[model samples]
Target: MTTESLAEPTMRVRPGWTVAVVLANVGVFAAWFGPIQVLLAKQSEALAPDNKEFVFGLVTGIGAAVSVVAAPIWGAVSDRTTSRFGRRMPWTLGGALGAAAGLLVLSGAQGVALMLVGWCLVQLFGNAVLAAQTATVPDRVPVEQRGVVGGWVAVAQVPGALVGTALATVFGGIAVGYIACAIFVVLSVLPYVARAQDARLVVAPAFVLRDFLRGFWISPRRYPDFGWAWLTRFLFNVGNSIGLLYLFYYLQDEVGVPDAGTSVLVLTAIYSVCTLVTAIAFGAWSDRLGRRKIFVVASGLVMAVAAVVLAFWPTWPGAVLGAIVLGIGFGVYLSVDFALITEVLPNAVDRAKDLGVINIANSLPQVIAPVIAAPIVKHLGGYPVLYLLSAVITALAGVLVGKVRSVK
Candidate 1:
């Protein structure tokens, strides 16, 4: 396929294409989330037992900061690419390989500085893969089918995170765990890279420096739907990130789980199952109904309720319940919200760039979560207060999604 044919993707994407996209997402997320969910914390503890939280937060915050810059830049570059092999393919393959290299660096790191470098590399390249892959949805799939397809793509995160965590846990040693994750990252992405029928850009766009720089900023006043969509996503992720970032510590410090690592796996399992059930189902339902906003609003509110459950109850049973609720809410939000965002995009030519900008909502939370969460968790009523704050933010996200007038 060529870029000219995909001006407004009108045909249904084949099932094979959807499967490849889902698998690629699973790999990208597995590489990214594995460290976030497990290995990074262990490394931080190993390096600085007394101040592990600070180390973990700092490392992750800086890495996410790198992602904030890398995603949009890579997206813009790919937009202008004229590679015969296809604009997204080279980056998709290159990014996966680069991320694997980063994981290898992480595997060998004996100190915080090296750990920080490795993680930053992973985030930088991982976003390259993500930005390119996300653009493909709007490039190939019709608007009507996006909810169902988006649901399948969004749900990949559950398995990706679970598989990554499982690998980290099963490997036992820090170095070996990192190695295993790196291997999976490379293997899982290969199929998609090989099979993808990416739209090839025959002619590169002229690069006028001033215009190029200006293109990155989509005016919120002019593009209100995009702005509202971005804000709601940012708010939703802020709640989600704050809630999940310190879960390992939460289990260890508050719940007093026997094996914190294994407990995380168990909780994630429960979360994954619930997410699996609701993600595609709700997405398909929304596609049938031809509605997006209602599902998004309801999901955010449900997520808020889940956060409240965690705040009020800190027991094992409470954690399980929280995971189930959160999974259901997140599944719905992720699927429908993705389809909604694509519909509101300001330019067909800039799909990757716009989505990258939207992705800032996803990555920025990682940067902000640790900065805010660290202070709150340490001095401001600890986990309960932190979780209450999560509930409030997510509920606000639900309410604010109503402002997106373009998609309903």
Candidate 2:
């Protein structure tokens, strides 16, 4: 800890910085990941329909798999970096620019191979910022204030997703939609780069692959709550992604919208409004309650129950209602879980890196679930089975979260 940090806590500095980081994440989400959500859902319809779903899933999975593998190395690098601008800001700026370029590449993709390459780049470059971003909280904020910090980060997600959704209508279609998103990423990184306090900590590189590769072999048994946190994250993302992957489709197929363009706008609006309302409330509450595990477990169970309702009745109202309830649960989970992870984190010296590692559990399930869902839908039946699977898997994730005994 810095000597300045050791002085009696100042109300002015920390909260503002934390809020800036959260806003940056909001910007990244709106501009970077938001545009891609629609493409991920609808791309198969245009690009070799028979294989598009599976291919998209594979690309995302492979990229996410690569992320889990790579985040620690990037975190380690950031930990050691001593750039003029600050360790984290330099990484964030570079990653944001790289991600913007990746989006342009993805926008121009003509075939599956090119698209996959673009997607891979997005995961690698974009997360370079994300790793640094997540780590900054640990480096800059007092450990005790993590819940409030996490709340800020959680609140950022809704606007980001909503911004992307808004672009479709304003920009007119997928092509212009993605272009608008790129604008958001660029804008989001600039303030942090400009305002980010120059961190004085010195970081030095460790040059062995074993340093990064060894984490997988380390058992969470060593950290009792680690397994629970990881599994809950996995289950939550799986169920969430399955439902999300179909939002654009559901609006068209179920809502019977006349214009495809309009459907995109409608879904985005609904998603944004729902998310904004719930995430704000739940995120703030979790911080106040200081009971992360119970909130997470309850959220997961609620999610599973909502999934069951949707699975049985695949109508417009059912889907919308399910989306509302599911959104509430997800909002609660999303708002608090990361804060929860920060508290139960296994190692202090490696706090940011471990949180990044656990985050993989969240994304990996996303990659795995859709890869499995595509085939089941194309051949076995349709999204019903996928919904059921999502419910079962997510409920299992709740059970795992129940296993966590620390950090509550």
Where is the poorest 10-residue window by lDDT in model 2? 1-10
lDDT of 1 at 274: 88
Would you list the C-alpha lDDT of every candidate in the order shown? 0.90, 0.68
Model 1 Cα shift for residue 253 (angstroms): 0.2
Point to the candidate with the largest lDDT: 1
Q: How close is candidate 1 to the true structure, as a TM-score?
A: 0.98
**Clash counts for the predictions, in order:** 0, 2
Check candidate 2 and list the clashing pairs. 30-160, 80-203
- As a TM-score, model 2 comes out at 0.89
Which residue pairs clash within candidate 1? none
User: Taking the tens digit of each residue's C-alpha lDDT, what string does model 1 give over 1-408?
Assistant: 345624898889889888888888888898988889989999999999999999999999999999988888888988877787677888888898999999999999999999999999999989888998898888888999999998888778899999889988988988888888888878877888888777788777788999988988999999999999999999999999999999999999988898889889899989988888888799999999999999999998999999999999999999999999999998899889999999999988888889999999999999999999999999999999999999999999999999999888
Clashes of 2: 2
Residue-level lDDT of model 2, residues 161-248, one tens digit each, is: 7776676456655566666777777788777777888554544445467765675344777876777777778777877777666556
CA error at residue 268 for candidate 2, angstroms = 3.7
